[model samples]
Target: MVSISRRTFVTATVAALAAPARGARAQEGSPRAGGRLSFVIQPEPTTLVCFNTTEGPAIQASTKVVEGLLTYDFELNPKPQLATAWSVSEDGLQYRFELRRNVKWHDGQPFRAADVVYSIGLLKSAHPRGRTTFANLLEAGAVDEHTVVLKLSKPAPYLLYALAAGESPIVPRHIYDGKGDPLQNPNNRAPIGTGPFVFKEWVLGNYVGYVRNPNYWDSPKPYLDALLVRVIPDGAARAVAFETGELDLGGSTPVSPLDLERFRSLPHLGQETRGYEYSPTLYGLEFNLDHPILKSPQVRKAIAHAVDPAVVLNVAWYGLGERTVSIVSPTLKRFYNAKVPTYSYDPKAAAKLLDEAGFPLRGRWRFALTHDFQPFGENFKRSGEALKSALAAVGIDVTVRGQDFPSYLKRVYTDRDYDFTFHPFTNMFDPTVGLQRFFTSDNYRKGVAFTNASHYSNPEVDQLFAQIAVESDATRRRALIDRFQEVVADELPVLPLMLSKPVTVYNRRVVGHTIDSAGVQGNFAEVWLRG
Candidate 1:
């Protein structure tokens, strides 16, 4: 195993800090303080609350209204947001944070350390990504009005990164504490947060609006008086809105590949492939091990061999994606494992494997299974159809079910009702942030949302994740993560198809639209429109 020296890690961190800063553009003159910015959001979230759902739309919408203890810069480096500064124990078991004083929630309630404690507790229990990311958090308590401390059972080196990823948005204890099942709280429709924007209104399937937070911690920020997020589901319509100056910004993947070149020719438009820096997402087909046919590793391997990711990239993604075998994307410099087992496009091999696994096509099709296409983007349906057609050639019949964001989450994450699903597993900043939960057996709760949907449990893989979590040494941690990927590749729990690049389009009149590596979830506090 190759060791990642401390120097290398420091260099990476330094390099990240050295990246281009995000804020008002220098050429755009002084930062003006007032204008409404209209933008396009493709997926219409079921709820305005981000913590209740893992839908990308919900999270992106909530980002403007809610603020976390920390957030990432353009280069994916952790920086202060709600919390001004922080310190960690030498052993990495305890964390101390200094909360920003004089901050008030959108409802005028003073922000306090108790809110931090309550928010952390809520994340540990209710939030999907937070459940695994903050699993080691033994206790979190407020030391004083402006101070909070977190006690972990074991070392969690990536905890800060997880907190900064926008998954665990801090909510007010007064509003959410006594609410029956915080997930179902009505306040989710109109959240009260301490961020730069105040939730003004939400019209389902139409639009969600936000006005400037007058009492925001940072004065004179959120230059725009209001932000109007239009739900334009059709890619062409969104592109047209952007082109016609009807929308100041087009949210992630708002402009389809077919329309990208045309938009590039327009001088008033700007394109970005940044903002997904922290989340190196892997798009793939996740198998449900609970199913009898899919329980066989050979069948899973055959399915992997049947589908050609290159073809999917061309037809569905328009060659905008990179083929991947490992669950982690190659962009994650430190933890990516390039040597994992890869499956080539070979239908003959897939058929032979199916025959050996007892599902031989003597006269009729070997078996039929249902697949759910996760509503990540419009192209998911095309990708699902491609996979279904590919598997048909191997005598495996598949029925593809396309669902909206809410229904898809309910069926796959809550009900666990399907045999296979096409979706992207994201937030892969570190092994602990995104990848660990999928492999750990303990995370496979029956009705829990965004746990182990695949129901895959390997003792060795679980042990490796546990070891990787507490291992403080950078070198040893990378080694353990490499081993974990090898186990995942061997088991074929999730056949990784491609790594997706999130695209964001905007009108050049909108200045200070900082495109961070965090992708579409970029901060809009400083964005101002030019007349």
Candidate 2:
């Protein structure tokens, strides 16, 4: 256990720790035309809540309509979008982004740095990722109509990647409307943008359609005359549609690994199978540190010991997941402290640890676990049942609960009313953004009151995380990360379980697609129809 930095456990479960502050691949291809590509995706995202948004889908849809300062290339490299190029201040406290001349908002207004500056102003000071990314430039300033400078209060290393996500999606300044509820902005229903597509029509419950931008800065691009996004929640229904040619692309409903061969084996669907490259996303059980029974390190360790992540890989996950040692995955290989304990199957050890922790037997403690319903969407349903049996052998009692994804997220994540739940997180290109959401106190799970679920707080760990965030040198920062991991192991904070192998399905009619580790970003600019 010495490998465990023995620090005050993350000091908290994660939702409140100071982070290394946050943190590319490229795919290239030619544009093609004359084909319609569509794929099935689990209906997840809907509104741009800004501070409280929880997904990537709607943003993905919105991005096509709203251009950002810096965009990603096929390999995930930072390329200029609205901002053609930029430079940084010598002190590393300010960043200047120069807008691409002649760009315009979908509404026909000339694109300007003032819009960028205004959009960033909406980022709540409490938003962890936003605050951390812009930590250097505590705020933004307009140098001119086209040039905006971001001045930092410190040297934040992960700022660029943070800007890459929610922080940089430029919103219409007028659309925000200064209302208290930005999510209800009229813009969300038919938002404007400066991309290849313009606001066409949004038919709630059916589809959102966008027509090609006639005034697009770049002509001969976005070959599709129109783009349509249909909302179909059923995975099978979506897949059937993709198989028939109802869509030019599918964004949800992952292709199962088992059916990969069979699905691809069928004609006209192989090309549609693809996903964002593997990034640092993780899915595992979140312990309610508030639970009296789970408070002991032995209990957390026992639960980790009892669950067989390998069985999860082979069964529910279909051998599609990579077992995780620390919370950090291989996509985030650098932050990983390999010295942490690995996942192991030891029912006997699990029971022993619980017994030592004062539980008379497995069934001794009663508990509840919950998740949104989606045909075993949590992936750990059966595995969790198996653990129930194993824990019963030692005297712990358990119950599993199911709710719709929306309600589950609202209660568990937004409201913090959950006891424990099956939490599966999508990967992010930036470690700071992804991990910070889970660890920062500003975030909550469930609909009840919010508290840092881990009940973990340590002044020393917090201090270290602060230093890690601002440290400009690579070597010192990494060393601090190692220290963070050790602290997690000691606290047994959020037990690291398993990482899943991503499965993507596509149609053969599609071409010029590349997947990067961020899980789904790459070559969008170069993706052309090949039918």
Candidate 3:
């Protein structure tokens, strides 16, 4: 019984059979190299700074040591890394690129075009979804030392899907120029990348090594000579270190749906839930609208009709997931909005919207609230104790808490402190890269690590996310992203639960690992080691 098969990222003929039309991975024999792979990364990346954190384990531990001027090619399209080519203009407001010659930067310097115009002006002035993913940059220099250009103020057809998103990595303008606060750069914990592994050591909470760059600009591809990673924040100690072979990879959610049927009866295990089919990602419960009882939209629609997303997808994702009431993930079929408003599983219509939002029920608790829990899986502490037993069967008490992963990104993005949080919002492939900066009020700034952690302002969701970011008429940007998901599903700020898929397991003597859908930027440069 070894079938497995569940990889999806549909269309483009199933992402050209999901990997291998240009990021090579056909594999059968020949292509031997040295070995040392390892891999685990579960909650232990406070900084190995992949452009100062949106933390998917610090951008999957800096996508094999950073380098991006276009990457995604498991049919999330746009390829050329470190810009081997690019072009745009016809009023898409200019672009250019063409860099990659003699590349270097794993401290061997070189890699210019002024380091891709200083990594797009440090991802549009310090990244946290970098000012809405470089919001129509008006300038970006160096059209020489191997070319680069930019100049946009308007038309940004998803800007090369946000520069093939591993969130624009190309750093090193002489180690972040006089680095005072390139997010407190000490080369963001020893990073100097051109990618194919080089930043060699990160012991905080145990392992994070890397080695083989041997001048890695695709020369003899990264056939692994070292890469440890291993942070294993207990999901049954990362499935007993991937069933005792001591892990040769686990990356995404690392087995914990009751240890995935005992690692599918491990015969030297190797399971994969297809490289995130272009990152759908939703999983839910956000709230924190400066929490004085989650600032009433009738108490966040009475906690989205008091939690049930099919019992949070069959008791915290054992039924593995899909419910989703719009944070846009119907496998992103062109801006998914499949008729928004569905908070159905009425706990007496959530006790009549918390007794018409004035919240009655005095002693039996009308509100307690706390939540937190996102230490990246144990299904976010069993969906925060199944959303505190479905908001304590509608009288609401909660209190959950958990933390770790830099104190849950410092209490939901630098101290907005939370009153509710379960996490997972990932790069939803568009609606201006994941639901318009979580409902922009200029992405709610307090210490800005932005994703608008529900400070959720709404002058009509900030004027329909500024006309869904320059709406280039794809039927009026799908009617302004279906009217910004019908005004954030009628203002529940954030609740649209379940829609995950992320799983990755590996260890059949590992070879060519390429799981796209960009969860942790999976492309270990043609992963190797099969002997």
Best by TM-score: 1
Q: Residue by residue across 144-251, what tens digits does model 3's lDDT show?
A: 898888888897667667775367777788887876778887878888888888877788988989889988888797888888888876678778878888887775
In candidate 3, list every pair of residues with a backbone clash: 9-277, 278-517
Off by over 4 Å in 2: 1-30, 48-52, 73-76, 124-129, 165-167, 174-182, 255-261, 271-279, 360-380, 393-395, 404-419, 425-427, 440-451, 515-523
The deviation in Å at residue 249 for candidate 2 is 2.2
How do the predictions measure up, each by TM-score? 0.85, 0.82, 0.36
TM-score of candidate 2 relative to the true fold: 0.82
lDDT of 2 by residue, 1-531 (tens): 001121221111122221110221122244455444343335645652233353556655665677666544324445455666566555556667767788777777887777888777665342434555565567788888888888778877666555543335777676664765676677766778777777677667677677777788866656666666667766566656766667545543354454555566677775332344324456666776766776677888887787777665666666666877776665555466779665477878887787777765334553434322223454556656655565565556666556665665565546555556545554355445556445544444344322245545556566666777777666788888777767766677676667655554556555543432222332133345654
Per-model root-mean-square deviation over C-alphas: 4.3, 8.1, 19.2
Give me the runs in candidate 1 sitting further than 4 Å from their true place: 1-24, 27-29, 107-109, 174-187, 203-205, 233-236, 290-294, 347-371, 375-378, 392-419, 447-449
Candidate 1 displacement at residue 419 in angstroms:
4.3
How does residue 92 of candidate 2 score in lDDT? 56
Q: Ten residues in a row with the worst lDDT in model 1?
A: 2-11
